[model samples]
Target chain A: MTKISAEGICKSFAGPRQRVEAVRSFSLDVREGEFVCLVGPSGCGKSTFLRIVAGLMEATSGRLEIHRDAEDGRPLNSMVFQEYAVFPWKTVSENVAFGLAMRNVPRKERDARTAEWIDRVGLRRFAHHYPHQLSGGMRQRVGIARALANDPEILLMDEPLGALDAQTRTVLQEELLRIWQSRRKTVMYVTHSIEEAVLLGDRVVLMTAHPGTNKAEFTVPLERPRTLQTTTDPQFSRLSYQIWEELRDEVQRSMEENA
Target chain B: MSSGGQRNRTREEDGKAHTGAGLMSPAAGTVLLRWVALFVLFNGAMTVLRLWEPLWWAAALVNFVLLVRIAEQGALLVPARFARTYERSLAVAFPLVLLAGWQLVVGAEILSPTWFPPPTRIVRALWELATGFDEFTGTSLFGRPWEIPARLAEDGLKDGAAAFTAESHLFATLMRVFAGFAIGAVPGVLLGMVMGVSRTVRAMVDATLSAFYVLPKIAIFPIMMLVFPNPFGEGPKIAVVAISAFFLVAINTMVGVRDIEPVYLEAGRNYGATGRRMFRHVIIPAALPVIFGGLRIALGTALIVIIAIEFVRSRTGVGYLTFYYWEILSPDKMYAGLVVVMILGVGLTTGLKALERVVMPWRRDPGRSDPGG
Candidate 1:
């Protein structure tokens, strides 16, 4: 089934002296249980595209739909925002249970689900701690737990591991794949890292910067449980190198558009 | 503390050839030089006091030498083997300096004891006033207590509560201050929160309050008395105290709201938190420390207004007693009543500080209080 479909989505940011077209006539579709990552240079509007899918922002002229079971359940889409977006005032457990509470989940059920996810993320020891008390890596764990506790059909992630240390990022990347394998949820991940895209995604969607439109889409032959060993493999480098060639010419266009 | 200390250490390390553990150390000479200078200043003041013996000089020298020993270890002011902070050094040094300066003025006899009321004299007066329970009781400093239809000592006062009792007077004054403070503070806090949050309310309300706050509450008291019912029956002078506290709280609440950080609000936005949740969880906690600060200022202002109002016309409390003493021109009694007022100020300030510690335990800049603030 098509978990989510985006049809010719167009978006622009209106400035005082000019209208800056960010994404123009962009379109894509993600099948249920598929992992997709969008990658580009700095100004690619990759985050904007993910935000549109999350229903955080509206497209100027396009149709985006989430196909879910309409009779008995409503589809939920949760976003893991870039950096430390976890609520500072809430404990790890409380932050993870935020969506559940919003849906008026019973106190007992919320705690039970939050505890299960906290243990899943290896943050059982830090469950009572506030977000400010945790490091960047721990906070991201809380964010993941918060999103998964809602049991959403679609997870929209905007550079979730971007602020973490090198080691923490590597660890979280594997953890994310492990999470996806167990849950089999459709995810639209945005990032600037090419290796991350090749390793985690089933399909990599590359976006051009100026009036950001689809540049090219590549399917990674690399399979599940992909790790650093995959990066050393010849196929991984060939796919990553091919993506870089298209990205380098488009990066220049992005800079000119920004100027 | 970690970030702030790390920042300082970075600057220090950049300046020196040292790195890491060595960078935590200060220059021995710098610490020694400060220690010697402080000891000299303390001794210099003691010389004027004419109370320093050879023993004090010896102790001062020993203190200087011990300070130099620690300074040499590159651990100056890190609190000796006892794990003490440099705060002690500052605390001891400041009071000693003030006393030294005070002793010089008093020793020179530049002013008469009567007019000057030196620290020694105030201490003596306080002691004598405390001991003379009978002579000090049952009368105003001027000569008599309040005119009471029945003895107030018999009614509600516990044993040893007061030197003398006037039924109508003391209750009237206590009730007035309490009632006025409550009447003003409640609305003041509510209005303050509203105005603090809303641009519309703030624009409309701020002008009127700023104008009211600027006016000396005492100056407006006469006009207010003319407009309202004085009644003169005397349960409490509630009007006088209310006007004082209301304006003070309102002014503070406005300032406290403005002091909150914008980043906190941005953090709340992603959670889809708005309206009441935003206020309950974010804005109020952020403004709490500052609002408590305003309450401290208001408490003092409330007392001042009470005194000024009671002095104009009222039957009870220390303010009326002060007026009665001044009318007779008994300087000693006037001084005694004035002493009571000073004690009240000190008590209020101390109480507020203690209250802040209790109510805002989260606010104690953890870096400062946790072993190394």
Candidate 2:
């Protein structure tokens, strides 16, 4: 079933000197329970597009929709931000329970679900600790747990592991795959890393730089239950390299535009 | 093997030479002797130049430098294990040295005792102020706390309350500070929050608020007096304090709220926090650290404004006591009043710090491992 559909979506910002187009005529169709990764160069508006889908930002012009089941009481989408936007004031359990608390979920259910997610993220020991007390990787875990605990129809991630160290990133990637395998939610993951996209997503959608638009798409032929060891697979390397070839030109173009 | 043995012998000789050189370097004993000689030389020069007033000050300046050098050397001589204690002691000792110098200068009649009374005299004056009631002003510094129980027993609640009334300078000042702080801070924070959240409100009031903020709060005392129904009452004085505190807190709170990370707000909105929920879960908690910062600044401003107002208008406050003592040419009493004000400032700031800790437990130093963790 088609869960998310975007047709010719455009977003522009009014700059100090001129109107800057960020995303132009971006289009994608995401299937239910399918992990779709949007890979692009810097300033490609991949994050902006994700924000639009999350309802945090508005598209200038387009038909963008997340088809919801009338019976489902969960939120349409919950975002895991690039910066690990966990509340510094709240403990891990509280941050995980934030969405449920906002929805006025009962105390018993909220605590149970929050505890469950905290354990899922391997943050059970730090459940009572604030975001500032946690490391970058742990903080991102809280962010992921928060989105998952919300039980949203679709999980929107914007470079969720982008700020972490290489080892931390790899560990989280495995954890993410493990979590997703258990509860397969529709996800739109935006990343700059081709390998991450190939490793995580069932389909990788490449975007052009500077006023981003869809350029190419590649279906990941890798098997599920993927691990860090999967990156060593010959097909994984070949697919990552192929995506890099398409993305290198756009990365160069972006650097020039920025200059 | 012979060449290696020679190299090892040279290395041993080098280590011995290094240790010998270290031993020759100015040890603590040498430093102490040097400091002692300098101290005596400076003191002797100071004694000789004491007859000449201009040269005496120059000698005193030289002596002061020597004293500081001695203190630094003394600190270095302290063992590493007692470093923290030594540091604290140095802080206390420096002030004591200043006080001793003050005593000597005044005692020797280098400075007039009447105008620059020694610290001993100030302590005596403070004790008198605390203990004795002034017949002339019909007031005291702390009121008769010892008489409170007796008065309550004899006169009951109505007259017993007199013991706690604003007859004491300290009590009056405290009441004004607390009352004005609450009056100003509450509305200031609320208005600041409103202005922070709404750009229209911010634009509307920001300019006028800034104008009022920069205008010296003391300059508006007369205006506040005129605004109040009774110009001579506590109302005008408290109002002036409130106005000063209001501007500081409001501006700071607004900045605090506005400075909240946009990403947090986005996350809040995305996670279904709206209206009051948004405020409680996101905005207020996020802005709390800054709000406390504003409150702390506002509190300090409130104290300053109140003290200044009391100096001009109040008959029963620490400021009034200080100024009155000056008018009476009682420098000791005036110094005592200043001491009280300093104590009050420290006490209030400490209280605010405690409150800040309680309000924002999340901001505690991350170095301290949490009990839960």
Candidate 3:
């Protein structure tokens, strides 16, 4: 049940000063419903990697595939972006129902499905509210609900909770865990936070800058129903510290290069 | 920025400190007191000069309270306490404080007020204009003296001004502004939306419009006159308003579209929306506030064009009426016509402001309770 495989992927960006290799020789295989985390320094191609898998951008050179066999007929992967991307004018219900609306779902069913998902994200109160009225965390929940509404087999999230506060971030993380448990879609979550990677990810892909590529992957041995309290456990700390050590040098190197 | 036509900007900025619940500060108190004193002084002088009634004081007081309320809310008030702006000493007040001062100068033979008569004369002139539709009734059919209003009156409008009713010269001029606005604004909105979404289109438009935008459109008046027929009537005037407004709205819409975050576009794409779907659901709503901003700017520009065109040559619009009075050198009627033009302009702007509230109710500027006025 392979959800997606990116074999020998690479990404490069052209800058005014010079050509920058943001990712190179990055390879990974995610199983169906496996929650994978791409953790790295700021300039590392975690987002680039996620984008390639989501079919938003083509990798410089790689083989990418989705499990076409799954009768879902929804796309191989869909993404929930960071920042406030919810269409401001549409109600929360419309945003959640966007994919089905695109597919021309009958108005009644779209309403029902949208209501269900809106309630799933605990935004039932704000189902008719515009995104501008909602807080940043609430807006992010809209983004999450929008992504999940499609029932895509694979969901790619790029620093989805980075813009939120500590309290909101933890709440959303638990929400993500609960949602992931129920639906079990393959997820590639990108982040600069090591703690986030440890808490939510099943396999953390620690990446580095300067020809960004996978440095190592650690399988989280800890159990879920995971929370911020889980981050205090010795196992979570050991894994996070290891990932930090892998990212430490690359981050400093990136800062110097950027400066 | 709009040519200091309004003398008081800080009046509102100062008033902001003394809202419904706030402790009205020292500076706020001084401004309010000054306004009140000015209202009293202006009316007191007028009362003294005209052998004016005690009722004038009540009117002046009501105006003052409303004026303070308007200044407090940073909004304009109808029945504005204009007299309150002159509340210093009646003896030393400026010439045009309440038109009483102007009347005194004219009556006392200090200066010929034929150039700037008192407001009472202007009000008298307005009353005359309303009744005597015989003399100043807007002439129709250009070459002939066909009375458009008389014909309308023969049909109906027992009480309404015949010549000023719909299908008359005044209504005709209004229709031109609206028709031209729609012509320009519709194209402006569509083209602007396209340009806003695409960098290539935006770049193309920016280069072209910036050139024409800076070239004062008045310069084109001569060129347009030569190209069209002798009568600058509805055709050239409408074209002028449309183009003037078109650029403002188009550019604003472009900015609105261009300014939308990449995130929203991607969200649309992620949901399987492409091309028209993306534009319809994603870009348009995202760009509405900016588009409306353009529309507002275009409306003001359209009015400006209407005035300038009539000033150049015409009969019947408020602008044309002003020019006719100016030609006859009747300052009272000319000032009266100018007041009419001002009322129309204010009415149009206020109408569009109300429209903006209805159309894009979600549009908001950050931290402000209201979206915009």
Best candidate according to TM-score: 2
Candidate maximizing DockQ: 2
Task: Give per-model CA RMSD.
Answer: 7.9, 5.9, 8.1
> Which segments of model 3 are wrong by more than 4 Å?
B1-112, B130-169, B202-205, B229-231, B364-373
What's the C-alpha lDDT at position B359 in model 2?
85
Q: lDDT per residue, candidate 2, A1-259, as tens digits?
A: 9999999999999999999999999999999999999999988999999999999989999999889985556889999998769999998899999999998889999999999999988888899888888888899999999999999999999999999998889889999999999999999999998999999999999999989999999999999889888989999999999999999999999999999
Q: What is candidate 1's local distance difference test score?
A: 0.71
TM-score of 2: 0.91
| Model 1: CAPRI class | incorrect
Better of 2 and 3 by lDDT: 2
Q: What TM-score fits each model?
A: 0.70, 0.91, 0.80
Off by over 4 Å in 1: A8-25, A40-52, A56-61, A70-75, A210-213, A249-259, B1-84, B124-153, B156-228, B231-373
TM-score of chain B of each: 0.61, 0.86, 0.66
Candidate 1 residue lDDT tens string, A235-259: 9999999999989888887677668
Q: Residue by residue across B9-101, what tens digits does model 1's lDDT show?
A: 765555356534464346544655665676676666767876444345454455555454444333442545644445556557656655554
Candidate maximizing lDDT: 2
Q: What is the C-alpha lDDT of each candidate?
A: 0.71, 0.89, 0.75
Clashes of 1: 3
Give the worst 10-residue stretch by lDDT in candidate 2 chain A.
Answer: A65-74
